[model samples]
Target: MALECINLEHVPASHTIHAALFQNIKNASFLHQQLLAGNTEFEYALIDASVIISRLHALAAIYRAVNDLLGNKLRSRNVHSEIVFSLSPNNNIAESFRRFGISPETTSLLVIKVSTPSSPAAGEDIQSHLSKVVDGEQVDFSDGVLRAMTDMVRVKKIYKLNYSSGVNGRGKENAVYGSDRTSQDSKELEMLILGSMALRGATN
Candidate 1:
């Protein structure tokens, strides 16, 4: 029952999102297979949590995907898959899926289901559906949970960031919050990476 229904800013009311974080998943491979098989019941965006740095890092990707969906500009199969694609800095859809999508070994997971006017399912309905299929303990979708799930080494590698001291792009280092070095730098890196991924769908 750890599912959260989030009302996004600027998104239409008909597009409420249901997001959940799962830990110590026992059926990751099964779930991954379901997605690969194109099971209609497994339409939720299943993300590998290790590549995520914070809730906003995940939210930024969701925002960009949903925004594109609203504009009829989806670059992938659907909004759910596009959420994973939006996390990548490049436009390679399959690579994005391979990197961010669930795998056989993924233990920590992020599940996102968008309820649009075309497919309006209540939060309770989505929660019930996930609870039955996903074999993991649901937890709050907060920064603390997400931070523990993040793999710093993998995140830097995925984004091709040079150093761990700080993120280098769009003057983000200068824009970093004045706080503890480790945590503050991580936040900056997440922000910088989010900005980088967001720029992929930018329009003139």
Candidate 2:
């Protein structure tokens, strides 16, 4: 199936992470509405893929949120919402949802489902549900796929890595990997984003 079952290290064995990517989403508004209505079946972390940098970037956020879940330190409604909230450099839950979470206009979408002992979801079940609900092309969740969908400008701005860093605000110059310098710059930006995510509440 297109849904990948990820085995994250340092987490409980009962917690299994299932993720999927979708392109050319046609019913983002409907999905957004399900979230707004608090549909229990639609409890996945529905993120806007444009702001994502890579698979690692997304995994870092998931790791943080899952850790929080295990520690009983979740600040959001659940692990799914916490995953979205963990992407922000700041502790604004609502704003994080607006910037990182899915919207009506989101074309490329990232869906994360953490199956816990309490609410266990099989990989097949997740894949089937997503296939029916999300009207989009299911693609492999890979770094290469994510790179094509990333909006570096939005990512940098959200992480506050714009003017302070020497890299240009527009993603074009920094994203070009034809040159070694640009490739290194892109990697540096990913590191910066991870750092920002890691230090989210500590700074404030």
Candidate 3:
């Protein structure tokens, strides 16, 4: 009832992301790196205990990527970017966007045209608009990273794959960008934000 299923074919705008992004594994590759992060099986294979700590390595890699994105760009006065982490309903893109910063135009709703209608996490249309426009098989920054153009906010997502005993990823905001979003951290983060801005401007 929450508008789970959709048809992307109906949403023409998404087609613009075609080829440039959807054609490669790079866009979504970030997911593969972090999804299976906390399993101790890697360490148990002789020293599986190392698997737990290794999880951070992957996470750090992601942070590094984010750093890269941010370091070179994202320093303008108009750019408002925020990162969110999702843990429930399996931390899929749907849940990831649920916690994302909301803009007036795109409240709690997300439209997707997933082939599997039975998929429990196929995203929901917040307002339940009867004639909601559903877009199919399009480029979405939903699950792992969402980068939006200037208007208001630039949002990214973190899948909380680990917790106390595992990679729960609590307080990710502080962990990633720090509480103030302006605190001094490694030069890596500064460069990452700047890099994001440069990339965004290049696209324009």
Top-lDDT structure, candidate number: 2
Q: State the local distance difference test value for candidate 1.
A: 0.85
What root-mean-square deviation over C-alphas does model 2 reach? 2.3
lDDT (tens digit, per residue) of candidate 2 on 1-204 = 378999999988899999999988999999999999999999999999989978889999999999999999999999999999999999899999999999999999999999999999999999999989999999989877777787777777788776233245333334445477666766787898899989888987
For 20-101, candidate 3 gives per-residue lDDT tens digits of 0111122122222222353221110000011112222222322332343335432211111111221111223334334332
Taking all chains together, each candidate's TM-score versus the true structure is 0.89, 0.93, 0.17
Clashing pairs in 1: none
In model 3, where do residues sit more than 4 Å from their true spots?
1-110, 117-148, 151-204
In model 2, the runs with Cα more than 4 Å from the true position are 163-178
Question: Each candidate: what lDDT?
Answer: 0.85, 0.88, 0.24
